[model samples]
Target: MTSYVVSFPIRDTVVRSDNNIPWVLAMHSNVVSIFSCFRRAAATCRSISCNTGNDLSLWAKERVLAPYISSERRNRIERVLENRTRNVVVVLEHLHSKGNENAVYRSMDALGFQEAHSITADEESEAGQASGDPRTDAGARKWLQIRKWHTTRDCLLHLKSRGYQIIATAMNNRDNSSLPVQDVDFDNKIAFVFGAEKDGVSDLAVEMADVCCFIPMIGFTQSFNVSVAAALILYETRMRRIRMFGRNGDLTDEEKRSLLVEFYVRALTSSKARRVLQKYKYDATDSSMTENI
Candidate 1:
């Protein structure tokens, strides 16, 4: 799926309504435009999808609903959807390493990725202890506690299996110097990986990546923090996709349904709820209902 950075001009209050079906429909229209642009520019672009704060909020709601639904049914639905829109997956990995989930959350919020799937080692450890199913629990453990270097490696392998070219951000290398951030071709399914603070990306990450890119910097600082680099790269990719394709490089209708279901399953949680409420408070809105409840 081709991923686009959507810029919806609607107010937050309007988009956050209980009956947000209309807003969703409108947003879908905008996404269609982005998809169209992607198709024209990068004929090889496979699917198109979007990551947004509002969509993530919906996923959090699904988390609340999970326990109420039959696990078999829920899992069936989630798996089906995940498969359907498996083309373009955006990950925010090792973001919690900074010891401030809130900072990472806010950065994702700014990127309109309110419902991005966030897997932490602690959460995975707990899930492992709670589940009886070895397969499910094992998967959770892998997601939660894998070594930092392995995280990027696994991501690259997983995406490549699904026919994606992994593009990662780092200081430019000799072979990658010709392919700067601006020169990257989004015509193919691609995954852009960002590493954690201090160490930047691991050697494995750079090695596994099909292309490495660097953001041209002017300041004395050698590099941007991981989150900033992510935003800059994602924005640039979005812009390039739009310019090349015009508005059509997006997911298929089937893909959209699948992604929304998967996102909803991964994102619905008490932690996410608390995060969203805190966001409202930080923005100086009245959140008494959320708090008192």
Candidate 2:
């Protein structure tokens, strides 16, 4: 169960819901293309999941429903699927917040990441709010903050139960003095936990991480944003895994199929737009869905 983490851009259609949709969508699409190219080159891996902040856009949703999309869209997706042979899951964090969630959704549309599963904060919290016309306390909002934290925790726990180590990006007693990013062995299933923007990883995330690592920096900047940090670390880790273990560093064929099916179901059902997955064969007993926070 070797896993790699990637961040997804918001979708374009989502941005259009706001006025600045086009520009935001374009920016994220470029980012998605760049990562897709990297994943293409690193064909020996499977991106277990991408961590997105809330905002599920139409374009982003298309990526998840790729397996069940029209032949044309499926072909486009399959073309990029080359070189990248693993099924990666996308996890959205704290994306339910008003402004950030909207932006993130637009970003996803631009990036072409489909919505799989969303974990929100509790239903009663004041922060559990949504952004839309006549914004009111409909009690329908999900508390994404709580969801994001617990999702990471559960992901780590699940991986650990399967015998994988959990590593986190954080400053430790030995910063840069510890093992270089390239030296980390990623053959075993591992979860790389990251924190929010203003703050580095949460103390809980740091404590839960089996090993805390920091990236080597030379400039005046003390740290990188959480998303950027995650991207860099995932890239480095993917490279190390490929160089060290080759294809064996990735998930088994069985796991890949399972993940693909799992994601397919979620993405297709994310919105009422598509139902193509209804024809596919899936295990009804597979309870891979994460618990709502």
Candidate 3:
């Protein structure tokens, strides 16, 4: 045995060189190379993690928020989403009461209807509506999507393009072929058109209507208030739809996935919740927007 000696420490393990300088040098080089690879691997992992955490996509927000959601709230979100529908909807034609508009929204939300259309008295638009919150309704509307059309014709035409039959409402006397509200066919994709009690249904709306309907009455009042009419009609439609299709809602799997993420993001409600999302790089500005219902 030679007397030459050297020390190479790795994890406090000292390899005895046995006085072979070339072997010692090779072993040291290997240790250094191994450590270099380990450091590279660790850096790569960190970079991937950082990029994933900074992603602001809805699915990314969902991934970050999933752990924070309580089982109860998650299940509630699922239940509500399961019952909501975009198939059947309502169209308001220049209703006089903004309060009535809010009330209509409340009814729609309470009935698990997801979308509504309206004819804005002003020259506005009815496109790309993702939410609605009217101060007049005591914050009763949820994340209910509303689209407003400037004219009744435009609203009717848009609905027609989407394969929806425009069912306009008026008293039975206004149209000879007007069916009772309950008697009307709810099987088809429908957009129920309601107008203010004072002015009644628009002449243009009646002309564009695929079919006309009127709520049955036995009392002295010839017509129900617009808000009352919405509640009644929506409740009836939801019930009839369930019976007709044997399902609570008609949203597809893809629709459910999209909506589920939105509901999850919306549930990050409290200020404390906002801070939690911030750590995950979520945009907190969206959290400030609270929907009604």
Candidates in order, TM-scores: namely 0.46, 0.47, 0.70
Q: Where does the lowest 10-residue lDDT sum fall in candidate 3? A: 15-24
- Prediction 2 TM-score vs. true: 0.47
Which candidate leads the pack in TM-score? 3
What candidate 3 gets wrong by more than 4 Å, as runs, is 1-57, 123-138, 172-175, 272-293
Model 1, which residues run further than 4 Å from truth?
Answer: 1-88, 91-150, 174-178, 259-293
**Model 3 over residues 221-254: C-alpha lDDT tens digits?**
7878888998898888888888888875777886
What overall lDDT, based on C-alpha atoms, would model 1 receive against the true structure? Answer: 0.47
Better of 1 and 3 by lDDT: 3
- RMSD over all Cα atoms, model 2: 18.2
In model 1, the Cα lDDT at residue 106 comes to 43
- Candidate 1 on 178-222: residue-level lDDT in tens? 266888877887666666577665677678878887888889997
lDDT by residue (1-293, candidate 2, tens digit) is 22233233434311222221121123444676655544442431212122233323323334445645456644543432222322222233334335433333333323322222233456523564334322331211221111233355675565566565666666663333335556555656555555455665555556666776778889999787554565566566555655665632244455334444444443343333343322222232333433321
Best by lDDT: 3
Q: Rank the candidates by TM-score, best first.
A: 3, 2, 1
